[model samples]
Target chain A: MVFSKEVKSVRTQTWIGIMSVASLVAIAGIFLKVAMSTQPREENYENITKPGYAIRRKYFWALLIVSVVCLVISVISFPYPAIMEAKITGEPVVVKATGFQFGWELDKDVLPVGKPVRFDVTAKDVNHGFGIYYHGKDGSLKKGIFVAQTQAMPDYINKLYVTFKDPGVYRIWCLEYCGAAHHIMTYEFRVE
Target chain B: MDVADRSMYERRVSGIALGYGAITLVLFGVTVFFGVIMRTSQGEFISVRPDVLYEFMTLHSIGAGGSLMAGVMAVMWYTLRKHLDMSMNIMQVVFGIIGAAVVTIVAVTLLGYYGTGWTFLYPLPFKSAGAWYDFAPGMWLLALMCVIFAFAMSWIDVIRAASKKYGFSNAMGWTLISGTAKPENVPPPVVLISTVTAACGLLSLVAGFIVVSLMLIHWANPSYYLDYLFIKNLIYYFGHIVMNMIMYMCAAIVYELMPIYANRPWKSNKIVAISWNSAFVAVTLAYWHHLLQDFPQPLIFQFLGVFGSYMAAFPATVVTITGTLILIYKSGMKWKVAPLYMYLGLMGWAIGGFWAVMDAGFNQAVHNTMYVPSHFHTYLLVGAAFIFVGGLYHITEELGGCRDTFEDKLGLWTWFVGGYGFVLWFMISGVLGTPRRYAVQMPGTEIYSTAAVYFAWTVVFGLLIAIARYLTRLQSVKPLRG
Candidate 1:
């Protein structure tokens, strides 16, 4: 099972890497072609402006439609509404998390698997990041992938909701740069 | 303005700009070196203490931002002088303040060990966890106050001068948009952009001044309490707007220079006018995107963040990028270093914008990750830096009669390859979920940092060659003749 999950992760990374590279290359190539082109001395301004405006109109509309669609889709996937709803309904286990310069103090060290956990995260002294990382059985963070996170600002509570499907150990690391020892600002917990 | 007066004005402004550009380029080189040091520390190639690494990170941010802001301000001032009689005395004052701030920032970060990130989020600077001296944060804030005051002074002068030359409304292209003015009577594209940039920049500077003053007050009086979320919002607002203004200032330069190279008029029509006016609003609201991860932020503002981020791209894509491509398409323009850098710079801006919009929308996945820096470095390092360098080369060749050589061309290509390669690693690491600003990397993430170090060195080597070329030309430059 571990091997299979690793394979899946690698596949996803490779796919994203290839897609990003391809998009950048395609964009760069188009710009390079235009850059290398020599303008004709006899070109007419009218000929260029007319078609250019026409194409620009189409491009503008296309961008608008695509961006709006993405916005709606992303908004739907946002974790805020669920977290807010969980807070109002009191359906999830509430874990109070307070971050300091080099540590996180959680009210609860254990949570239930297959149930929602609401982390009411805030900072005691300064701003820190409440980043949850998956932990391996050997007591180390797993490959640095953040499971979820929210800012832990002093005097403010940022609610982050997460559900652990499988029973395992997990770790919390400060994602924001708070101090010199920020890297060591980690806390461990169990979800059973 | 008479012909002789205009020529004299050009010479004076260009000389100041050339000097400022040289200083900025040198600062940029130092910042790049600092960046390499941070990366190498993360890669475990050098064993620096974590506190030392944070110090370098702080300096890197301050130096790069200061250099870019000061450099682009000079570029805008030089370009705007063609149309408006901006005060050279004010420009000198701005330069002096920035120079002093740079020195203070270096001392505070390196000597006093002020490791609070450049954002200098409230309470963090005061509660330094014993990593830095108590006086460091105060000194840092004081220096920042000076920088903001300088920028504020510059913007006030730009607005006052522009309003005098062309009515404020006309300068902002509002008259063109409202059809109160004829198309031929419209301000040039640079004027329109500079006015909008100045207005937004001045507003952001006010926010910066307020926030820094509040922090300074808190530093002095520990009993005085402030709202953390409100302060965070203000910080990001000021930081985000100032950063965006750097790009907009470069856009102003492009609008002015691209036309001369293409031998075409890139005028401010109704559409161009409307685009920039909307940009002014979009850029202001887009700061909300930086606060997206702060869940306590209002939901309405979060939604606006996404919307504003999307809208911010409209002006650049619809007007500036497309217009430049179309202008040069069949104009039989030469592929000089200036045009080449400007062309690639625009391309970088577009590419970086795509990634930025993605990150802004999907903050849950990438907020504070290396992805944040990935997108910014793409835009700032490759996008704004290229534009500024191109502007400098353009002015140097035009006013000082400096010519590009084979070595200059080779150096540019090297910089291009190394820069893209360096940022590519950052992008990949971001995708892999590596968090940014970590002195010690996670177990599996150090590999990317190790690989990035080579690319960083390549970039430094390329930049050194470019600087050498620039200096060689500078020594041979003759005075401008009418």
Candidate 2:
């Protein structure tokens, strides 16, 4: 047998190799152009005004260099995209006071009328629309954050600005729809 | 008709249809079970929680989407080969199945990334780790290749077959050209709709390939997200149009196939065809409506999209109302479960089509939240599901099988009632403001809890009915073969 096992047809092989190389080069050029075009401005998460808008660090050029280097090193080598997370803070929180069949429960179970403390409210199961029902305090109802669902991530944490005006027991319940015991999934918290 | 020739062709087509239907049945079962898990696990976490959630979601989407797609293909092929006298290459048909299978696998893999349903948004593909779940871009590309190849081959065969029988200017062409018209006066509306839908599928393949390729590029280089929402734009058009194509394909099956049972051939061919083609072209521009729901796409495109959205329903309504009324009123007919199922399917399609069209109203967009999908799912699941069932029923004899027993009838009815009840309950919950895919809803803020009780009971009853019917059918398979 020939040392090269009858080397493949030169013209056909050369054409395919050239074509592939040209295609790859074209693709690389386009990629580099995109990567070098403009570094993505770091999303300014500290801009408390916009809750979910994240400004990530400009790493597009770095990523581009790595991708190009990989392509040159091994065309068959798969490229794993980098994970970019924008930390969101100062998001609004909503605490539901009522609409629960049985009513709302506090972690401490009760609070004095004048007590000042911060409470983070979350749905035990399913999403419950909750927020203090008051006039002009921007009585916006907070929808539960569906963890893992990107759509619900923003709505997950809502900040509540409220002060108990009177002494009473407030009730909260799961609002959206959990299951068979959903109606019974309620609790009461008292302020005095 | 030559008995051998008819039997040979019939047997082959039926064989393929049966195989497709059987696989579809299994997929449906998988989807329902996984759907229960996905639904039940909301707000609650089990060990392997995210992974399980991912698994359930992946299988659920693929099972629902892929099974329906296969059902559409099987029925469309059966209708064309038998009713329309359109002969396709056997190899091409097999290739189409292979493509679907490959796509199913790719779809499942993508689900691991839990890409958040079929319209996997671009930037997210690399943003989240749970989303990737060890899935590579190669799988997606391979699957894409399979589907494109399959559709390309099928497209070739359809052109060859239809062209051989009728020229480019044939009535079939008129349906695509002018929209829906009278059969006697124009071309067969069903054929026209099917052809146009297939054409859309071809176009979608192009877009899908481009989008998938872009996704691969993004995977290779994270910086590609800065590339100006290029992939995002392609996906909206590709995903929406492909979905419409699937729906149109199911509609095509019923429009053509239901007539045989009713003893009425399709009429108003040119009008119907023209309506579908118009719908097809209009929908190509309409996908931007989804964009208006979120993200930054041009407002003008959204305006055009809203208008285009309505165009799809015009054909849907014209075909459904006119066809069903003719079948029921003009033609004196006895009520059988199969034909009843077809009518029910028509109702579902019409209702869903109406809701989808209605939801496009600018003011009405807010209320579309969960209800829109509920309304649309009625068409996707019940409408399309019933047609698939009807096709299966029709092909029973040809599949070397038949559902002759009273139990089988009961089982078929069970499928009908169960499917309808499930979808109706699901849709009603949406209307009541129960968000879709919530692991759990809070106790009292919404009425969905009450609806959930009803929904759960309905599902249980429906599941029992389905199991009984499936068992009965399994037992009777032997007798039907003889």
True-contact fraction per candidate equals 0.70, 0.00
* Weakest lDDT window of 10 consecutive positions for candidate 2 chain A: A77-86
Model 2 has a clash total of 50
Which candidate gets the maximum TM-score versus the true structure?
Answer: 1
TM-score of chain B of each: 0.97, 0.83
Model 1 ranges off by over 4 Å:
A1-22, A39-42, A81-90, A137-142, B1-11, B480-482
Q: For candidate 2, write residues B1-482 as lDDT tens digits.
A: 59767666655554566656665555665576666555545423322255445545555765577666766776777676643555546544654656566455646564544333454555444444333543544465456556556655665555555555554345346633554433343445565666667777778778887887777776677666434245556876877777677677777777776666555556544446556667777788777655443222354565566667655555565445444443443243444555555666666676666555444433111222355555666677667666676666656633435445565556555555555555555454443333443334443224443443344344444544544454344433332342
Cα lDDT for residue B343, candidate 1:
82
Q: Point to the candidate with the largest DockQ.
A: 1
Q: Per-candidate TM vs. native?
A: 0.95, 0.65
CAPRI class of candidate 1: medium
Those runs of model 2 whose alpha carbons end farther than 4 Å from true positions after fitting are: A1-192, B1-8, B43-51, B83-115, B134-138, B175-187, B225-228, B362-368, B397-404, B412-421, B428-435, B440-450, B453-482
**Model 1 C-alpha lDDT per residue in residues A1-192, reported as the tens digit of each score:** 122143223344444456567767876987877777655653687887788789889999998998899789667656684445744434889999999989999999989877778899998999998877666544554574456778999878888887766456778878888999998898989988
Model 1 over residues B1-482: C-alpha lDDT tens digits?
Answer: 89778777766676678878888988988987898899888988998899999999999988897898899889888888888888998999999999999999999999999998788988889898789999999999999999999999999988998888788999898898888986555788898899999999999999999999999999899899999889988999999999989999999999999999888888888888898889989988889998887887888899899889999889988888888888887788888998788788888898888788877877776778787887888888888988888888887887777778998888788888888988899989987768889999876789999998888888888888877777676665454333
Individual DockQ of the candidates?
0.60, 0.01
Best by lDDT: 1
